[model samples]
Target: MKLQLRYLLVFAFLCFFSVSFAQRKKEIPQTTRLLFVLDASGSMNSAWEGDTRINIARQILSDMIDSIANVPYVEVAMRVYGHQYNFKQKNCQDSKLEVAFGSRNNNQIRTMLDGLQPKGTTPIAYSLEQATKDFPNDGKDTRNVIVMITDGIEACDGDPCAISRGLQQKGIFLKPFIVGMGIEPKYAKGFECMGRFFNAKSSRQFKGFLQEVVKQTLGKTTVTVELLDERNQPREANVHMAFIDQATDKARYNIVHFRDKGGKTDELDIDAIPTYDLIVYTTPPVLKKNVEIIGGRHNVIKVATPQGQLNIVQNGSLDYSTGHSAIVQKQGNHEILVNQQVNEPHNYLIGNYRVEVLTRPTTVFENVRVNQGKTTTLNVKRPGVVTILNKLSGYGSIYVVKSDGSEDWVMNLPEKGIPRTNFALQPGRYRFVFRSSEANDSSYSKSVFFNLSEGGAFTLDILRL
Candidate 1:
């Protein structure tokens, strides 16, 4: 009796522990919502690949629902278009959600498909527009997916591409997986921008395509950003990374290195797809386009963004100018990169650049190379400061003529009082011409030539001249 009691107690304790562990290991409930937009137009009744297109679609879609029936936390919905009115009825808005999103909806979807018949004209775009209302937007972490099966293009003069784009923008759906049954390759461009369009000429191809779509919609992949250094080695850290979906041009993942989690760069979990653009924020932004992330695989992307610094060195001191500016342009094509007032040092990528200083005669420095991890100093010759004291008490205009015979109007001196005008002239030979007018009288002019050098300040009294 004692041995039997001890055995019973041990069995009970083991059973309790097993049950507790199982409960702890259970997966969290993540919602994966799928909506099927089927084409039940008159064209689907035509015979194709040894059976009607609608019949083949019904069989394949039913099989797909059955395959995912036991998938936990998944909800499925169905919408059929053009099955309500006759082909000549002109009913473009004949679309209905036969079964709303619900768990274990395989039987409901199959029953609805069995009763569907090809009747009205094709309204592909209108049907897609109505599909936005089929999914719930409760702000849960649900993967909203739309699988559109159709045999023809939009005959209702509506833009399906624009609708799909809007739906993806609203976060109501992913890029709709379009399966074109018995569609010509030439017309495939119509649905190219709608989503990942697959041209299936037969039922077998359609089945494979559907399977692939399901796998992609349900799987997740890993993405690692390999920041490359000067030697093209993956050693850079503290980079801001963004993964944008190329199909929708939407940012799906954004993270900053060394800041998100104790300066550690971990792999990112992303939806398994082929069209992602990886952008790494560095000195000059780095972009890697058309990145493919396959299921059950680790994707490592190497981004090379070697950078250097630009230090503007003023050779001489002249405090006459309030702001200094330069324009950095690409060497060959002269594409402007930086413009406006730039006084401090800044970092740039490793490339040849041309610096155009916004001064008298516009000084230009060409073929300036920014080495990796090093600073390139540009020694610029400072201009001379010239101050003119107009004691004649009249309105006057100052002009500086260059050696090449070109002249620039410097400033206009007022006539009310003894006014002063200043000019920051480049270090060269310049002819200064001044025109003055006495109270309501004709004007008189005078010209003077001066050799200006770096850091030189000259003051001229017009009355004495």
Candidate 2:
């Protein structure tokens, strides 16, 4: 009888500790609200990539809807312009809303997209005005986004540029990302300017334009953690962490970095560690033994006592692989946070507190080349301090100070290595320079002269320094 009583007590203690470390997430859900203004005017009847503009628009809208449908707390609304284009009648009223503001199921959205037929004059400006009115402005904290995909210029009254400006002035809520789908080169500028107007042009190039917008909507943040290594400098590669659902103990971390479909270092694939919205990545100390972990929801994971501590690093993506292993060395109630929203007091409590240590991965990049008014591709063999001609780190923008120090060359690399941009720049001796928001003087890369005189197209790979 005493043995059974002890077992029950042990089980109760474990349960208490496990429940304490878990956190609760607030239900104040937010969404990256999106609006798609698709042009279905007669001009859209033209062919693009062997498909009609109407069909292409349908495909793009459908694909985007499918991609974002699974993400919780996201709502997408689409509006079709110039659906009833009437060149002979020249009626601006032909441009009207095909779908109102509301939640759209995939099939419903797809159906609405299919129903669009190109038949009216292109009142692209009128369509913009209509979209401007469609979005609700209840003064909520939602992030609104509007994406206008058109293949022609304004076909009715009101200047499209002025209309764009007006929308900005109004609380249309989100910024606009205009896409020129096979439109004339002359008009592409006007549409591109719309993105600039909203300060949404993260990339000056064309390839990753749309994809970058999507990535930005996914949300990004800087992870900062200070740890006492008792050794030399702390390295991120030695640390690991993962996203956990506050409701469950399921977790997954970045085990490897690969070139994503967009071909940029800004992406990481999160494998399913468990079928839970949140999971604890590290094996915490055994003092909180026999803890039950629920899967498939936002989870809360925390320590049981204040004595237990977790180590973290900053300035890079956190990795939760084996580095997040934890242990229990003390007893008492403790708290930890699973996937709590940023800056929220969403800590979970735990009994018999254990520490789950997480560390970030460190990367070293070398042999970076920076050229002026040139498109150069720098290949970092592995993730590390990538320098261009011994200048900037990682990828994107690389600044170079000339040997004579007479001028500065600000070179931009395509976020992805697109074939058109690969081997696109002329070869010359150059030095590397780093540009970052932080005021870290030592982070700058050393100056090196590199000549791209290989003549024929050749791949220059960057190795670890």
Candidate 3:
């Protein structure tokens, strides 16, 4: 009897251990994976006001990483392009990944981010494909994100948006936020269109685009669901229940039972609902059921960190820098941009972040180009200014190199930023090419040639492309 009792105790201990292990597995933190797709194509080598844009990008990214160092349970990953040897001979076909996905150890990520310089053809599609592999959809509860920063249109084969959509269709909600650096205002439309489609535009208001992205991943909310009938009426009048993460793509459902409307309620698991349809009063005489529901409003309560706090937004970036609070008691799924700002260096952590993200900038430009006589009458088309702007402040200066290889003009101006310059010469067989001061700087543009009429008036139209 003694031996048997000992054996029984051992068996019970084993069962307890198994149960504990299973519970621990269930409690693992839901992960958010960020993939940094830094452009290393040839066009990123230019300098901005003598400062290399690549260097600036490195500093900014480093600062960002340092800012988020204190955020709990957050991990980051990075990948770079244009590191191919003999990239020119390869027709920019060699846009390869130098760093695979990995955790952002300050030292490791810093080294990788700092070592990047622009060069090579823009293989936007290929880089995205490589990054997708970093986020495996094999039943892992991880939110995947792709932050692609580029300054030019794609030079490699395959469409970036199509590739991103394909990944999304595969159960991977890949939100791609594009950062256009050192690109002309005329070409900003395509980037804006991409942001609109993905619902992830980095508002140009305060350079808080990337910061807003970080806040979005860190922010959480609790939603209360009160199921209503097809008549657009509330079934459980004034009976409140809470569902966590109510307004986000990832929602946690918890049901509460209030004995009566406006009365004390017992918090219960959502699964405790009598039926999947969540209908009560299921019995005899009345023969009533909260049957077949549709077309009802959902109230989404978005809560920011530091608990029960609020933020005020100006433009797309946050104006409330320090301790500020606000509540959003909005209903329905809002596809709106939220911005958060952290002004002080020490307060740049998760709870201290002030979230903000602005709407697309107001741009004024029609698709028209007129080439006039000795004085080429160029119309200034943009909401803010006629100067060139660098949406993505990385890579390097953008050099407008003439196809003849005679002289090149490099630009790194902000909004209404750089002054326009005119060229005096006999315009014949001239093609415009762009260059960057990065590792992938050798990729040239398709040469377009036009003849200059010796005396008669000749017109040439240059697309934003």
TM-score of each: 0.69, 0.40, 0.43
* lDDT value, candidate 2, whole model: 0.47
Tens-place lDDT per residue, model 1, 23-114, is 98895756989899899999999999889999999999999999999988889999989999998986999999999999898998999999
What value does the lDDT take at residue 161 in candidate 2? 73
lDDT of 2 by residue, 28-47 (tens): 65655677777777887876
Ranking by TM-score: 1, 3, 2
- Ordered by lDDT, highest first, the candidates read 1, 2, 3
Best by lDDT: 1
Candidate 1 residue 37 Cα shift, in angstroms, is 0.9
| Over 4 Å off, model 3 | 1-26, 85-87, 90-92, 136-140, 185-189, 192-207, 221-465
Residue 305 error, candidate 3, Å: 31
Better of 1 and 2 by lDDT: 1
- Candidate 1 lDDT score relative to the true structure: 0.80
Please say which candidate is ahead in TM-score: 1 or 3.
Answer: 1
- Identify the runs in model 2 with alpha carbons over 4 angstroms from their true place: 1-24, 137-139, 196-210, 219-465
Q: 146-246 in candidate 3: lDDT tens per residue?
A: 67766676677667767765665564544466766666766666555333212222223213655655554455422233333233333322222333221
